[model samples]
Target: MSQVSLVAARIAALQQAGSALALLQATQELASCADASAAPVLVEVLGFNNPGAAVAAVKGLISLGPAAVEALLQLDPVNYGARAWAVRALAGIGDVRGLELLLDALGSDVAASVRRAAAKGLGQLQLDELPPDQKQDVQGQCLGALLAATSDGEWVVRYAVAVGLELLAAGLPAGSPERQQAQQGLLTLQEAADGTPPVVQRRAKLALSRLELQ
Candidate 1:
């Protein structure tokens, strides 16, 4: 069979999956196929209650890269599950097209894991292809979001904030204000003792050290 036919067959299997295990298997196969045409089906699987299937779908969407961004953006806003999974896929893809969604998720998503992924995604965005002014503006936005997210109640999210700060700073000039602000944010996280988790503090300290070395 042709590759297109194989992908279609996988999509059909995913659509017709009658059991949890079957859905998982079909989603896995489709995701592994990494066909751009499978992006919609993979995204649809994110709305399902099955986590295993959703994980596979996220992988598939990430594999599709920027081609999957529009479909992910169009996911039903009411379906928080799908949105959360979409955030993860966008984070993994690190496409600049996902910038707004990642910022919103980091600042307001109720799910800590989603916020964590968004924080990381904001830092990892591919900005090299953009014009210098646009790149700086986007980096500034990401920096502000990561700084705000440092105070997040979840330790995991805070840890991700540290990560985001480091990544964003790394792309800026050594003495640039944005880079300095990012370093300051990391320092604040590192010194936070007011209920901050030790792990988060350690991660922040490590991020600060790495930034200094750069």
Candidate 2:
């Protein structure tokens, strides 16, 4: 079958899946195909109450690459609730428009998940994709926002910040102040053994160990 027809069939199947788990599974299948045609349906899926299904849709959009980003940009979330989910999907699929949304979301009093996703996106950005003149400034802002968020009220947000800081530190010059600070911050998270979940603490420790060797 043609790729277009296959995506259509997949979208139809996802729409027909009444069960949340079934929808989630179908969504992931569409995502694995990485077809741009699936982006619109996935965007609509963000409104679903099922977190797992919404996550699968977000992953689908991310897999769609630039096509998903463009489609997401055109969607105006008149409903405030949908806006956070849109920002999250944007966070996973970085484009200038998506980056703009993430930067704003990072500083806003939005959902912890939104803020966490923004932090991760900022760290994963390809600096070279940005204009040369804006690259340094944006990088600094990404790291600054991430470092300041190390003590976020939510452990998950703090864990995401730790991951961002670790990734940022990995690419920095030897003995750079930012690298030192990022490493210190990750260590702090790791040392907060009791306060943090084992999973988050383990992530922090892993990041710190890698950064320590860099």
Candidate 3:
């Protein structure tokens, strides 16, 4: 089949609620085609309203290695939501180049959702696994960003920042100051957790438990 047709077919399958693993495979295949023309299709499918589809798309893009970065980068933060998921996939792929991109997005992006995704991506990147000094730097950067976001007028932004902080704490050393600080942030989030979405609340709880602070 032609590249265009193949790409369209895959996207249609995704929209039809195809298997997550299959969609992920197609995402990588489409990304590897190196055809920017297929970007819109991939983005549309990747940005499915369903979180499951979104997660699969990100995983697929990550599997494409570096070639998917440019396509992933071109997605609009507000309209697509792919930018946020892209950061996650990139980080999961273990590419540190995404580190700078994620930081920039979290610090400057207008969309709270995107910024939240970036923050969570940083945690998934295992920034805490870096050398102590490097880990400190990354943690400091995220903390500063989260602090600012928490003060934003948007409740969603506040919640997102809280989630990011909680995730960051997961990999910290036992009884470390950073872990303690993150636990405090999670506690601050607890009061409003009931009002937030169940998934968000669950994530906060998981992160808190990971730190043994629950």
What's the ranking of the predictions by TM-score, best on top?
1, 2, 3
Model 2 has how many clashing residue pairs?
0
Per-residue lDDT value at 78 in model 3: 70
- Of the candidates shown, which would achieve the greatest TM-score relative to the real structure? 1
Per-model TM values vs. the true structure = 0.97, 0.76, 0.57
lDDT of 2 at 211: 71
Q: Candidate 1, residues 39-127: lDDT per residue as tens digits? A: 88889999998999998889888888998888898889899989999999999899998998999999999999999999999999989
Off by over 4 Å in 3: 1-57, 65-88, 91-94, 192-206
**What is the overall TM-score of model 1 with all chains considered together?**
0.97
| Per-prediction tally of clashes | 0, 0, 0
On lDDT, the leading prediction is 1
lDDT for predicted candidate 2 compared with the true structure:
0.77
Q: Whole-model lDDT, candidate 1?
A: 0.91
* Candidate 3 structure quality by residue, lDDT tens digits, 1-214: 9877877775665556467666666666555565545555655665755576576556556656656566666666676465666666665554445777777877777777677667666665555347779878877766666655555555566566666776677666768887777777776665454355555556566667766743
Q: Candidate 3: TM-score?
A: 0.57
